[model samples]
Target: MERKVLEVINLKKHYKGNKAVDGISFHLNAGEIVGLTGPNGAGKTTTIKCILGLLRKTKGRILVDGMDSTKQESKYKLAYIPETPDIYPMLTVWEHLKFIALAYYIDNWQEYGSEILKRFDLWDKKDSLGRDLSKGMRQKLSICCALLHKPDVFLVDEPLVGLDPKAIRELKDAFKALRAEGKSLLISTHMLDTAEGLCDRIVVLKKGTLIMEGTIEDLRHKVNAGEDTSLEDLFLEVTEDEKE
Candidate 1:
């Protein structure tokens, strides 16, 4: 059996009168890539925030590596990339990587840094300040920072928002490499095409509730769609079911 990297049981997050994450639950396995998706106001971001412990869940459980996130901080075992890039605008690329290495307490960062930067096509701007880089470049820098620690679980939100075609391809390869290294990911995105290519499984959410969760093939079957039907089509089916 695949090792469970993360799990949420009847997870609920209340924002005043709104039940932002209304009793949604799911589990992710090691080496698995799970896409969390839905239309706007579907609670995708809220669920991610709850998983990261950035927002407290009103009820139920969120277990990361078998540790209750509220009781213990196991953040060192995981990495998170929010919907928007959040890196120091004043820091140079090399300095940001160095800061990450220190934060992760990894001493042998010189070789690792070079390899990752080159893979992301960021070697040329290694000394560029974050404030001066293009949107795509800055996104790459955040991605590099997230991976520099080489944690077991990655939580990414809207990772492709600013990436170019080539950079997107590099990112796909990088995610595959991370999975090959026995890492798992929980990605939240509205980009169906990218999610279809990268996710091993998927979970659909609508109005703060889970609509479906399964492998791509399994999801296709659940939607009663043909094997060739795209994720976008299947997404429509799931959310439509929620509407009715």
Candidate 2:
């Protein structure tokens, strides 16, 4: 059996009386990419933050590589890219890579760092400080940092938000390569088409509850949608009650 990279069991988070995440559970297996999607206010971000230990969970268990996710050791095996890229303003593009390498204790990282810069078309901006880069460049830099250590699992939120067409294509290609190497990924995005094409399975949330989980075909079957039904339509049909 494939090793489970991450497992969330009966996870819950709440504020006052608002249940941001209400007893949701799922797992990402080695080499699998699972899409976590939901409408606005559906608890997607809360779920992710809980898993990352950014927010204290109201209840539940999160295991990363068979260890408690809140533990420091588990963090070493995980990487995250949020909707907005956060980088040190004084650090040059190249410095960011070096910083990551040192933090991850990567030996002989120079060649790999250089290759990553070139792959993302950021070689020419290597000396540019983070403050000098545009939104797209900043996003690219974030991607570079996240992948530099080659973590066992990746949790990306709105990864394509600021990427240009070329960067988008390159990032997608990189994700495919990571999967080929047996890394698990959990992608959270509002872009249904991208998720539909990239994910092995999808977990949907509505008002802090998991409404569905399955492949595109499996989802179509769950909703009684035709085989040709698009994910966008499926999502709409499943979450239509939210807007009512």
Candidate 3:
């Protein structure tokens, strides 16, 4: 049986009588990439923050490799890439990589770090400070940092946001490579077509509630869509509140 790398059961987040995430459950297994997608305000970010232990959940359980997500040890087993790349303005690209390497106690990270920078086309900017880099470069650097230690699972939010076409292709290939190596991934994004082609399964949320979870074909069937229907069409049908 494949091991569950990430699990969220009955997860809920309530703030001042406002329910951001209301009891949603999902799981990602080793070697699989699941898309956590929905329209804006669908609680995708909240769910991710909760799972990453950035926000305390009002009620629920999140397990990372079967360990409680609130534990520091559990955090070491996974990585996260938020929508906005957070990097130190004073740190150079290479310095950022070194920081992650040292923090994780990774021996001989130079070769791996160089390889990652090259793969993301940021090798030429290794000496550039974070503040000097463009949005796309910063995003790439953030991805490289998150991947430096190679955790068991990845929680990537809007990974393709600032990437150029080439960078986007490279990042998608990287995700596949991680899956090939038995690592799991949970991706959240509004790019339905990319998510459609890359993910094995998708979980959709609406107004803090999970409304659908399944493969592309399964979702089409659920929405009574034609065989040729695209994921965007299916999503529209599923999330529409004005359906006749």
Candidate 4:
């Protein structure tokens, strides 16, 4: 049996009358990559934040590595890469990795950090301050910081947005490598092509609710699409009625 590394059960978050996340449930098993894709305002970020315990959920449960997400130990078991790269403006690239290591109490993180930095093409900018880096470089640094911890589960949001082609390839390779190491990944992305190729299963959300969850073939079956039907087309078919 596959071990479940992350689980969200009937999760919900509300702001007065606005329901940002509404009873969405999903699980990511060890070594699996699950893509969370949806239209804007479909509650992707909100759901991630809830799982990260950055936001208090109005209702439901979240488990990280089989422990309640609210537990302090659970925090150490998962790492998050947000849609926006939030870095310390005054801190240099290397300093960011150092901070993550210290925060996660990860010993011997230097070699691993250096390796990831080189892979992301940020080795030369190790001495550069965060504010001095371009959008893509900042994104790269954020990924390095998250990777330095070697967490069991990774929550990635918009991972390919600002990446150059080389960096994008490296990130994709890293994802596979991590999976081989038995790490679970929950990737929330708007890039259908990336999801189609990289994710083992796809979860689609609409208006803060889960509309579908399954493999690409399962999705095709759900929509009665042909074998050649792309994820983008399947996504459009499901969401087109929402615009009406």
TM-score of 4: 0.90
Q: lDDT per prediction?
A: 0.85, 0.88, 0.89, 0.89
- Per-residue lDDT tens digits for candidate 3, residues 1-244, read 8899899999999999999999999999999999999888889999998998889999999999999998889998889987788889999999999999898999999999999899878999999999998776777788789889888888889889867887778678878877887989899987889899899999988889998899999998887889999888888887675355
Model 2 C-alpha lDDT per residue in residues 1-244, reported as the tens digit of each score: 8889899999999899999899999999999999998777888888888888889999999999999997899998898888888888999999999999888888898898999899878999999999998877787788789888878998888788767888777678878877997988899987888899999999998889898899999999988999899999999998785568
Model 3, position 12, has a per-residue lDDT of 98
Model 4 per-residue lDDT tens digits across residues 11-76: 999999999999999999999999999888899989999999899999999999889999998988
- What's the lDDT for residue 175 in model 1? 76
Off by over 4 Å in 1: 71-73, 104-108
How much does candidate 2 score in TM-score?
Answer: 0.91
Pairs that clash in candidate 1: none
Clash number by candidate, in order: 0, 0, 0, 0
Error of 2 at 131 (Å): 2.7
